[model samples]
Target: MADGVPMVATLAAKTMEVPGVHTLSLALDTHSPFDFDYGQFNMLYLFGAGEVAISIMGWHQGLLQHTIRAVGRVTRPLVALEVGQQLGLRGPFGRGWPLAQLRGRDLVFITAGLGCAPVVAAIHHAVANRDQYGRIVILQGVKHHADLLWQTQYRRWQALGECQVLLAASEEHRHRHHWRLGLVTELLALAEFDADHCAVMMCGPEIMMLAALKQLARLKVADEAVYMSLERNFQCGRGLCGHCQLGPYFVCKDGPVFHYPQVKPWLGREGV
Candidate 1:
């Protein structure tokens, strides 16, 4: 658990979809149990290939799950590894979503593009403790219907009467009945929830999140009640690198998850 020490994690199982997007279910050594709150991420190293930080998709039993999109050097090679291959893992690092504060409040999750990955763990947490909260709403947006991930998982969550899943794709699709066509924020306008008693958690590109924040403000959701996952160029997950700095805070150390008010000053600030 030292700053640079990487623990060996064996690949237990995998679910492959497209070439670059897949889920790797990993098993860490039992003696060195890896436990992390939902929304936290781990630094994954593929031996000599290199390492990259990815959010934990979900966790169950003794396995830790990550949904990886092979976009960069470290990740492109990672998705090709076979099931029994071993890789180095160095975390559970960074701050996570505040699930405790969401108890008894209507919960809304707004995810766009790959932003859905980080919120998957939080969705599982909400589903497992359904009775503890009011209504649960999830709005997902992608460029095309083909970009949707975890459709079956979202269906399971929707089976529960307290939860609802709404998806919006920017482009037209044959499956029109299932999802609306527009920005995800358009669907947000139709959602009926208690604005005063709801907590909103959003993840997406900076532009999408900034636009969503504006819509949330129109709904009267307090800045403190809204949370977001901010991604930056994080080299060292421990915050020593200064690569992921955002104004006065370090994105890797102080957050990947932060309440809106805590980060308002730096959101879209020039050259922070």
Candidate 2:
């Protein structure tokens, strides 16, 4: 398929990660494999409901996977799709994490809510090739314990020799042994990573990312060392539509993942 053209994809499998969220495994109609980078997104189009920009969860058994929360017009029907149903897919768009540049550096991953989906593949890649990186620090925040998706996966990462995983639940009343009750940013203090030689990748509500950025700066991490994956109302998948614009760059084309300094001027600013 040509760039920007939607290709037919069959629903291969669907797993419910949480109550309203699901991971959809889609098999493209094309014979060639569908390749995408960590932090890239694809436009999933339903026949009548329209398309929505969903982050590529990862590739599994040659199928493209996407974790979607059914909170919008396209996503609600997308989660309801049965196996064998078909949907339109338009790309593995936008820039991804600069893993090449990050090699040999300690990696710090910070995410809140469902934002982890975009960075999950990168984490997996780093873990799979652990020798290429230094220590791995993973920090996540959720409203409650039950809201934490991929709990088992986090545990597996935690068990790794050089990996540190910290989870926080902001609204939980009862204490969980493995989780702390506070904002995700609070866990930053306990994360084990070399601030001077670590690459920080963060995604979440803008407020949370902003907070994390401030904390990272206080810890002496350079703005150049931090990267962020931003979410926006992406209408066109390409930069033609201005819905996903940030400052002078388009989130869909220039980046869904960007160096902190690239977007610093417009981040958290109102009416951008």
Q: lDDT (CA) for every model shown?
A: 0.87, 0.92
Cα RMSD (angstroms) for every candidate in the order listed = 1.4, 1.0
Residue 220's C-alpha lDDT in candidate 2? 95
TM for every model, in the order presented, reads 0.96, 0.98
lDDT of 2 by residue, 1-272 (tens): 67678999999999999999999999998889878889999999999999999999899888999999999889999999999999999998999999988999999999999999999999999999999999999999999889989989998998899899899999992365558999999999888889989999998999999999889989999999999999999999889979988889999999999999999999988998
Q: Let me know the TM-score candidate 2 reaches against the reference structure.
A: 0.98
Candidate 1 Cα deviation (angstroms), residue 229: 0.5
Residue-level lDDT tens digits of model 1 in 35-99: 78888889999877788999998776788899999887899888888999999998889999999
Residue pairs of candidate 1 with colliding backbone atoms: none
TM-score of 1: 0.96
Cα deviation of 11, candidate 2, in Å: 0.6
